[model samples]
Target chain A: MNFDKELDARGMNCPLPILKTKKSLTDMVSGQVLKVISTDCGSVKDMQAFADQTGNTLVSQTEENGEYIFFMQKK
Target chain B: MKKMAIIATKGTLDMAYPPFILASTAAALGYEVQVFFTFYGLQLLRKDLSSVMISPLANPAMPMPVPMPVMVQMLPGMESMATMMMKQKLKKHGVASLQELRDLCLEAEVKFVACQMTVDLFEFDKSEFIDNIEYGGAATFLGFAGDTDICLFV
Candidate 1:
């Protein structure tokens, strides 16, 4: 998927991934997509929750091997 | 905008993580977040966090390299060892340090309010804490808490 920015949050746990995502999105224009790759299993649900609360769209999420990949669109 | 009010009353290393974690995360999610530090919890606002150590004594859930009986945990230097082990584990998992979490909260504009009563009761110098934080009593916090969408006491 095409995205305006990419955030590598691998190895970070809990709020770090979410916080980094929030920070990254603030730099992008609305409707632009962000690609985030994370290794924290907890971030799968957390990313969805963050997107839900912030009104940002989690365009899609997938897992390859042990890494979780997420596409988020800024609201 | 949603608002969150958290009352933090414990000062232990393990106990300290929750409020800061929630506050920062809530702020990231677009919530107006406030954390009120009272009693021992006020230690979190201290300029130096090096003294914050986790105690394994009486905490059976603490994951030590070996199963430690409470009697063994009570030995001298055990707290330091436990704290070191926990720190290593957290680092291995890429968890943010307590200082990092607090800094993140501040950067996210999460309001940190120190309990004035506790400060006075403990005779703590105002300069001992970080800047850009408010000092207030219960009523001051309740003003925000009463109308908040989510309120927690940690």
Candidate 2:
């Protein structure tokens, strides 16, 4: 997936990963894709909910080993 | 925006984290968050929390990687050590400090309401806090809480 920025939220727990993602996405241009890698199992649900809440589009998501990879296109 | 109200009632370090963390998270989730700081909770909005310490004596469930007994936690200097350890852990996790969290709340447009009665009772000066705060009484906070779909006392 093409991404304008990357956020490595591995090892971070709930809220931290999402908060960091929110902060990073705030600085990016609209319609840019943010690639997020998180180890928190909850990130699967958290990112989807976050994307919906913020009006961002979840372009793609996949899991490799334990890491949750998500591609979000900012609205 | 959906609204969320939080009641913060403790001043200890362990007690201080939840309100901000949850408030910021709710804000990120597209909720218009409001935090009512009353009684000891006022310390969370204090101008300087650099001296805040966790009450290890009261929190038995604290996630101390190595659990310590009550007597050991009661020893002199243990509380400060624990507070430092917790702060370090938060920093290591890339979590924002209290001041930064407060700024995030402001950035998120989270409404911070200071309890008027508590301030009057404690004889605290109003000027001792950061700017952009709103002052209100129990009724004011209750009115907001009543209107909010998600409200809790943290």
Backbone Cα, N, C clashes tallied per candidate: 0, 0
- TM-scores vs. true structure, each candidate: 0.97, 0.87
Best by TM-score: 1
For DockQ, the strongest prediction is 1
Model 1: residue A59 alpha-carbon error in angstroms = 0.8
Q: Per-residue CA lDDT of candidate 1, range B27-97, in tens?
A: 99999999999999999999998788899887878767878788888999998888888889989999999
Model 2 chain B worst lDDT window (10 residues): B93-102
Each candidate: what lDDT? 0.95, 0.86
The lDDT leader among the candidates is 1
Candidate 1 residues A1-75, lDDT tens each? Answer: 899999999999998999999999998999999999999999999999998889999999999999999999999
Residue B107, model 2: lDDT of 84
For B1-154, candidate 2 gives per-residue lDDT tens digits of: 7899999888888778789888988998789899999998887777888777885777887888787889898999988888898999987876667777777778888999988888999998888876788889889998889989899998
Model 2: per-residue Cα lDDT over A9-72, one tens digit each: 9988767788888988889988999999998888899899898888989899899999999998
